[model samples]
Target chain A: MIVARIIDSIWATRKAEELNGFKFVLGEELTSEGNGKRRIVAVDIVGAGIGDRVIITTGSSGRKMLGDENIPVDAVVVGIVDDDCNFK
Target chain B: MIVARIIDSIWATRKAEELNGFKFVLGEELTSEGNGKRRIVAVDIVGAGIGDRVIITTGSSGRKMLGDENIPVDAVVVGIVDDDCNFK
Candidate 1:
């Protein structure tokens, strides 16, 4: 899992059929220093909003999180962070 | 999926039991410009060697490639690149 911040929502008119009805969000990875690193698009499973610190699960775990292995998604927002002592 | 070059092999005396007998390699992501970027440690499933440009699969796909869902591995070398017109 990686810590990230939801930066924005994304919409695509044309995409894989398996990806339909899934909410996508742009997330920036957060370092322990609170710096943002690589940006990724992930399925928003936890209803995270922009500015929300989130926990992301990547790869097949995304499918596992949704209980479906055919979603063609590689990343997913699994949790919203309430507080973290490691980073502000 | 991502493109990377295997830079070095790794050995660990202690690791997760599920990871035993797996070959680990340090891989550096390759840009279209052929420059190296982020580095990652991945299980080498394709017998890739140091200096080999390889295709890597992350997350549960690594487990899928190995035909096991409980390997606890995140990244894997899925293929070795032979010729690429995109990068030199």
Candidate 2:
């Protein structure tokens, strides 16, 4: 999982069926060696909030978080990182 | 999932318990709009080879590929691309 900071919460009045109860967060990926300019939207199943450093899962495994491979989601927040962990 | 090219295979004689019997491959993520310079390590369950473009799932969702969410892996190869895919 890559380290990322939640930038904001995303709201979609109309979305796919499986995403109904899931919280979505906008985030910018973080890397220890270089700039992490890639922005992505991820489902927050771990209660991550804005400014929280989180571990995100992407792709089919991301879809699998909701128990289905057909879920439209490509990213999901699986863990919130503690300040003490050295990301490097 | 992100599209990436398998750069080479990875070998670890000693590894985490959940990672045993798994094939590890090194890869570079691909993007249609810009340079794909991000390098990553991924588990290959789909038979992707060196130089083959493949789809990868990352993070906790990535760990879920083995049916258990406790796997030590962070990325996984889920698909191989053909020549016809319009990645854009």
Candidate 3:
């Protein structure tokens, strides 16, 4: 799991059928210092918006969050953080 | 997937039961310029050794490579790179 901030939303007309109904967002990892350089595209399962700090899960655990094993996604936003003093 | 070089092997006397028969190696990610700071502990399934550049798959795909979805592993070395024009 990683703590990140949603930076932007992604839209693609032509993608794998399994990804059609999902909303994709770009997230930048959050570290104790600030935002880290690692960025990833993740499915927004928790209705997170831009600038929202979120908890992202990767790999099979991510796909399992969507209740399907066949989705072609490796990262998913599982939760939105209400408050955090660790990162700015 | 990511390209990395095996830096060292890891030995753990106490670990999860599902990881008993697997060999874990420390890998440093490789970039076009040189080695990146990102490092990971991965189960080596392709018999890779130190100094070998290898391809690693993460998540469920990695667990699937070992033919066991129940393994508590997120990364796995799937192949060793024979030759490459890029990266130092």
User: Pick by DockQ: which candidate is best?
Assistant: 2
B1-88: candidate 1 lDDT, tens digit per residue: 4557788998998999988899999998764344437889988756787998775657665556565778787777655655432332
The number of the candidate with the highest lDDT is: 3
Pairwise lDDT winner, candidates 2 and 3 = 3
lDDT of 2 by residue, A14-85 (tens): 987877888889988764346756888988876777998776656655565466666688777766665554
For every candidate, give the share of true A-B contacts it also has.
0.10, 0.08, 0.10
Interface RMSD of each: 9.4, 8.6, 9.6
In the range B1-88, model 3's lDDT, one tens digit per residue, is 4557899999999999989989999998764345345898998866888998765657775665455678798877765655532322
Shift of residue B26 alpha carbon in model 1, Å: 0.4
Comparing 1 with 2 on DockQ, the higher-scoring candidate is: 2
Residue B12 miss distance in model 2 (angstroms)? 24
Candidate 2 residue B80 C-alpha distance from true site, Å: 23
Weakest 10 consecutive residues, lDDT, candidate 3 chain B?
A: B79-88
Q: Estimate, for each residue in A1-88, the C-alpha lDDT of model 1 and write its tens digit.
A: 8888877665544334455688777677788665435665677877898899999888775667676664445777889988564554
Candidates 1 and 2 compared: the better one by TM-score is: 2
lDDT at A52 for candidate 1? 94
RMSD of 1: 9.0
Residue B85, candidate 2: alpha-carbon lDDT: 82
